[model samples]
Target: DQQVKQNSPSLSVQEGRISILNCDYTNSMFDYFLWYKKYPAEGPTFLISISSIKDKNEDGRFTVFLNKSAKHLSLHIVPSQPGDSAVYFCAASQTNRDDKIIFGKGTRLHILP
Candidate 1:
């Protein structure tokens, strides 16, 4: 079984609108949740993150929310821009265990201009 899961294969949104991506995890040991954006022919770049101690974390237009009880997490982008279109991966790590992180398959987001 996959430790991290992104049920949605892809998402489409209009520019200047909001984009939401969902993810789930089976591991309760995960204390840190992160969102990474990846472009073609490039590695994933960190976008936002939330620690288990906090329910939400935000940075500029990007925000990440974590529901530990439900083992669910989500990333929200406000005023989505065309430049934001990319594959987003949800990752989780148990800091106490090791530095290794588990990542979801990823969801492709398309921004319509």
Candidate 2:
């Protein structure tokens, strides 16, 4: 079974609006959470990340929040733009096992104009 899961296979958001993507994990040992974005042909790139010590991490238009007790995390994009349309993957891993990560099925986000 996948430790990390993205229930929604895709999401649609209006341009200039907020886009919220959710993720959940079954493993309680995961202490780090990360969001990755992938374009049509390019490799997945790091978008945002959070650690168990903190509940949230923000980087410019993107923010990631982690809820340890719930084994949940979310990625928020404010003022969604057309360029933001891509596949996003939620990933988790234990601090000690950084090399072995669990990734959820990517969620395809579409920004409607």
Candidate 3:
């Protein structure tokens, strides 16, 4: 079973539009959630993060929401730009000494100009 899964492998949207990415998790023990954006060969950069303690968190054009009961989370980007095209990965980890994170397959977002 996939502890974390990004159902959509890819998403496409026109520039200056809204982009929504979905993610789901199976493990209930995961307390820390994070989203990372990747461009080509470089490693993913931390976009935003939310603890299970909060329902939602937002920063600039990026926002993350967590639903503990449903075991799901999603990322929303407003007025998506062409430069925003990249792979997004959702990760989760337990809040303990072993902060090993589990990542989803990733979602490739293509923003059209």
Candidate 3 lDDT for residue 77:
99
RMSD, every candidate, angstroms: 0.8, 1.0, 1.0
Alpha-carbon local distance difference test for all models:
0.96, 0.94, 0.95
Where is model 3 more than 4 Å wrong at Cα?
A: 97-99
Residue 58, candidate 2: how far off, in angstroms?
0.5
How far does residue 99 in candidate 1 sit from its true spot (Å)?
A: 5.4
lDDT of 1 at 91: 97
* Alpha-carbon shift of residue 64 in model 2 (angstroms): 0.4
- Candidate with top TM-score is 1
Q: How far is candidate 1 from the true structure (C-alpha RMSD, Å)?
A: 0.8
TM-scores for every predicted model: 0.97, 0.96, 0.96
**Candidate 1 error regions (>4 Å):** none
Residue pairs with backbone overlap in model 2: none
lDDT of 2 by residue, 40-81 (tens): 989999888898999999999999989889999999999899
* Candidate 2 ranges with C-alpha deviation above 4 Å: none
